[model samples]
Target: MDNRFEVAVSAGTMRSDSSAAVRFPHRWTPGGVTVEADFTGAHLLHLAAAGCVLNDIYREAESLGIDVSGVRVTAAGGFDTTTWQSTGIDYSVEVSSDASADKLAHLLEVVDQVAEIPQAIRAGASVRRASSC
Candidate 1:
């Protein structure tokens, strides 16, 4: 995993109150969410995965009767300079919750298996320029 391509998203109690970054409304939290990633393709790609994981953490927490106060997800990977293809991605999860450690672990595991963006990237997708009017 390369720190050069890392992107992070934080929401709820995990979010920075002083960050100048504009916060986006998150369904799972009252204070919303903040993104710490650039607009580059690689940064955005990792941002998407980090954002999804952050969102699903809160979403699944509710369904499982766990109380999650905050979530921060970081994702990063390298790319082959020649072809610009991805080298692979790695992510880490930091959570704020009163739930038991085992419960928190279960929530993370479920989110990883179900988060749409990571799942899509893991399964792989074809990118093609679509013909448009």
Candidate 2:
């Protein structure tokens, strides 16, 4: 197996009798988690990073024989409007596990080096518009 996958999401605005809101549909997740339509582009970017890290923590922990009970990752950053580019991102990970501190730390360190989303961002992936409708 290639061990690689792609995800697609669609975003748009919806209007009801009371107000208009943004909607983002993530098809890859169970029930397709949706958030309030008020988030900025930067917020979504950071959210993807956080989600990837959290997922990877559990994956790596299981592979390393560490029993993880919980995991949380927070990713936050802002973009410069003038440049329309991300300024920087900061993330913190917290995990509840039965493993020793040293083992947990080692697992996190390995995940930090391998998590896909952050690595792609750090490597400066190119973005090009595919179509307009």
TM-score of each: 0.92, 0.70
**RMSD, each candidate, Å?**
2.0, 10.6
- lDDT of each residue in 3-104, candidate 2, tens digit only: 111121211121112234233333322322223223556667877776677667767887999876655466666666667667777777677777999999
Query: lDDT of each model, Cα atoms only?
Result: 0.87, 0.62
Residue runs of model 2 more than 4 Å from their true location after superposition: 1-38
What is candidate 2's local distance difference test score?
Answer: 0.62
TM-score of 1: 0.92
The top-ranked prediction according to lDDT is 1
User: What is the lDDT, from 0 to 100, of the residue 112 in candidate 2?
Assistant: 94
